[model samples]
Target: MTTKPAINLWSSSDHAAEYLSRAESVPHRTEGESALLEFIPPSTRRILDLGTGDGRLLALVKGELSERLRSEGTSPRVEAVAVDFSPAMLEAAARRFAGDPSVTIKIHNLDYPLPDLGKFDAVVSCFAIHHVTHERKRALYAEIYSLLNPGGVFCNLEHVASPTERLHDEMLSHLDKTPETEDPSNKLLDVETQLQWLQEIGFADVDCHWKWREFALLAGRVGAS
Candidate 1:
């Protein structure tokens, strides 16, 4: 079998540190995250968070689910697995979920196939996955499909490609940067192509659920028997 490309930046300390420092300041991220939460079925039991930087998105999702369950007078618990390649990010996630028996943090690079962590009711990712090459992204989506239980949902709050070079430059300009400053790690793909890939992989109801410039929330669900 052929080996896969390694996730380089994710294993670097500086890359993980830089992302964590700016993670909260990304424009329209919270809105996209909230929209992602809305796509997940409230009855979801287990979750898998891919490229879970500092476990931010997973924390948000778990917190929301907790509140909803509390209000409904139900004792539903969400078991979660948060995966990342960076040691720094893994440490941060461990600290973030310290003493929380519900979350399990694992260190795994997205460049390779997902581990046999079992199936999940919902799988989520945020501002991650684009670091992998386009081919790997497609393959990873297939792996995600295989790991989801029937009727499970996949929600990704992602960074997508701009429609034109001018628009791409404009987005960078808004962030006070240029192409040179753009993360070489990003392998941005168009939203349409990604949605099509999900559908082709047998995910139903696939769509770009929310969009703000180049940031978007993509969602889909597997059919239940």
Candidate 2:
């Protein structure tokens, strides 16, 4: 007997477009995004957004950092890289960041290792990353750790696995989605396992900053070496 290959429907333009249409409607997503932003260091000058669908979370981080800088009477400047593999998502991100010279959009699948994009002061993702295989998830966390500047932060507002099947069903109901209707691309991992991975990867202050059902904000800071 052979195991079937795992499915990832995000490559389909229709699937990607459909998700974008309802992206803002996910329950408690804004709250998670807000919590994720709070973990970003106010001094961050360079940021990278992984799986940056439509560049929503990246835009929020950039805006928040700019506000922090302005309040300190310093020049507000942030250079960003937004990455996504889906053609539809990449196009959306491109249009969203169009005319903003500070934001660079890159195409890369999360299943493979990340390209050399240099170090960043902050790295973020939202409702993404969970699409990768469990092994890839751990490897990606390690890669993220290696990409950070010392004292840099990683914030992932993600769709995490629930502790129990009943709870998972309940959460799905809250989102008006049945298990059968859930995204085939999702490969949710439990929060504790992921937090442990970050800690093992040498991240400091590893914690789940916020959570609402399956949605969670996991964050950590790289130590100054």
TM-score of each prediction: 0.95, 0.96
TM-score of decoy 2: 0.96
- The global C-alpha lDDT for each of the candidates, from Candidate 1 onward, is 0.89, 0.90
Residues 1-225 of candidate 2 have per-residue lDDT tens digits of 121246788878998888888888878888998898889988899999999988989999999988888888998678999999999999999999889999999999998999999999999999888888888889999999999999999999999998899999999898888989977677888999999999998999999989988899999999999
Cα lDDT of model 2 overall?
Answer: 0.90
Q: Which whole-number lDDT from 0 to 100 does residue 189 have in model 1?
A: 88
Q: What is the C-alpha RMSD of each candidate to the true structure, in Å?
A: 2.8, 2.1
* Candidate 2 stretches greater than 4 Å from native: 1-5
Deviation of model 1 at 124, angstroms: 0.2
The per-candidate count of clashes, in order, stands at: 0, 0
lDDT of 1 by residue, 1-225 (tens): 222344356678998898788877877788998899898888889999999989999999999888899999997778999999889999999999999999999989898898899999999999898888888989999999889999999999999899899999988876667999877777788999999999999999999989998898988899996
Q: Note the residue pairs that clash in candidate 1.
A: none
